[model samples]
Target: MWQFFHKLGSPKWFYGIATRFMPWLLASGLLLLVAGIVWGLAFAPKDYLQGNSYRIIFIHVPAAFLAQSIYIMMAFSAVVTLVWRMKLADVFVKAVAPVGLVFTFLSLFTGAVWGKPTWGTWWVWDARLTSMLILLFLYGGVIALDRAINDEKSAARAVAVLVLVGVVNIPIIKYSVDWWNTLHQPATFKLTEKPSMAVEMWVPLVLAILGLYLLFGWLACLRMKTEILIREQRTRWVRDLVLAGGK
Candidate 1:
């Protein structure tokens, strides 16, 4: 296990592995996403209460879940980079930041759209919503800090520290609906309790979540490959690869 972990820190190894996996990832991600969209948008029953507006949850919940999940992943990568000085870990941090931010923004946008019909207000200062907004800011901060720094290593360290510190917001975001009397509904899918949703309703939601996760993985790998190419442009193999591609 330790050997596997240490080996993963190597850029050449990770790059090779990532390249090998890219096709499968892309194919699977697209397949799942299409399936989810069809199931959610076409077959799923409309909400008895919110009617068609509730359909937005297919996109909204998955995005919201990914928003928080990717941040935690970024923070974990930060810890790995800081403790082990793994260049691949730094690459992961850089690769995931923009994706995380986009997902966070999607979540917020969908939430507001859903709010208009449900809450009769498009915006609110609710705890869950506010914390999620802050999460978006944190992702932006990481991306900006990384770009602003001149030295790559220095930038990685700085962003890593910021990510580690900002992680405290995650749990706050997770439990905010329960912690305070907020307009936001409590978690819909729970492991502890049987899902409150009917099978028709919940199946599509599950598929959407799985599809979003696969999409995130696919995008992350693409971004990481780009970063690797940029950083390794001067290397013999990279130069050879480019020259070969041009032939």
Candidate 2:
């Protein structure tokens, strides 16, 4: 187990692994996403209360879940980078920041769109919403800070600290609806209990969530491979890879 963990820090090893699985992840993710969206939008039972407007949840919920999940992944990478000083860990952080940012923005935008019909407003200062906005800023900060610093090692350390600090907001976002009288509703899905909605309503959501997670995995792997190439350009493997036309 320790040997496997140590191998994970090797850029060459990780690059090879990522290359092998990236295509599979992309294909599976897209397949699931399309199946889920089509099923939910075209066939699933419409909400008796919100009607078709609630269809946005198919997109919104998945994006929101992935946005938070990506940040939590980054937080773990931050720890790995800081403790083990693993180059690949920092590489993961840099590669995924923009992806996280995109998903976070998607969640917020879809929330606003969903909110207009539900809450009668496009935006609100609700706790969950506010913390999610803060999470977006945190992602931007990570990316900005990484680019701002001239030294790669220093930048990794700095970003790691910032990520650890920002992690406090995650719990706040998760429990905000329960802790406060917010307009945002409670989670539609929970691991501990059965889903509240019918099988037809939730089955597609499960597929969507799984699809989005796989898509994020594909994106992260793609970016990490590119980052590995850039960082390892002077190394023999990268040189050989380039000479072989990036095969």
Candidate 3:
């Protein structure tokens, strides 16, 4: 386990693994996403309450899930960066920040779009919504901090500390509906209990959620590979790879 963990810290090893798996990830993720969206939009029974507008959850739930999940993943990487001093960990933090930001923004945008008909408005200050907004800011802060610092190492350390601090918002985002009277509904899916939605309705959502997670993995690998090349440009391995490609 330690050996595998140590190997994961190697940029070259990760790049090679990612290269081999990237195509598979992309293919499977796309397949699942398309399947989920088509099935949900075309075949699944409409909500008796919200009607077709609830179909938007097919996209919104997955994007929202990815937004929060990516942050949690980043927080783990931040810990690894601070504790293990792994350059690859810092590379991951840098590479995935933009992706997280994009997903966070997507979630917020989609939520607003979904809200207009359901909530009778485009925006609200509800706890879940507010915390998610803060989450978006955290992603922006990480990206801004990374760009602001000239020194890579110093910037990584700063970002890691900031990530650890912002992690406190995650649980609040998770439990906001329960902790306070809020406009937001309870989680659409939960691990500890069966979903209240029908199997037909929720299966597509499950596919969507899984597909989005795989898609995030693929995107992270792509970004991390690019980051590794940039960071490792001075190394002999990188030089050899470049020279071979030139040949």
Best by lDDT: 2
Per-residue lDDT of candidate 3, residues 213-232 (tens digit): 88888999999989989889
List, residue by residue over 1-247, the lDDT tens digit for candidate 2.
9999999989999988998999999999999999899999999998999989998988999999999999999999999999999999999999999999999999999999999998899999989999999999999999999999999999999999999999999999999999999999999979999998889989999999899999999999999999998899999999988898864
Q: Which residue pairs in model 1 clash with each other?
A: none
- Among these predictions, the greatest TM-score belongs to 2
Kindly give the stretch of ten consecutive residues in candidate 1 with the minimal lDDT sum: 238-247
Off by over 4 Å in 2: none
lDDT of 3 at 93: 89
Ordering by lDDT: 2, 3, 1
Q: Higher TM-score: candidate 1 or 3?
A: 3
The lDDT per prediction is 0.90, 0.94, 0.92
Please give, for residues 129-183, the per-residue lDDT of candidate 1 as tens digits: 9999999999999999999999999999999999999999999999999899999
Number of backbone-clashing residue pairs for each candidate, in the order shown: 0, 0, 0
- The C-alpha RMSD of each candidate to the native structure, in angstroms, is 1.6, 0.7, 1.3
Give the TM-score of each candidate: 0.96, 0.99, 0.98
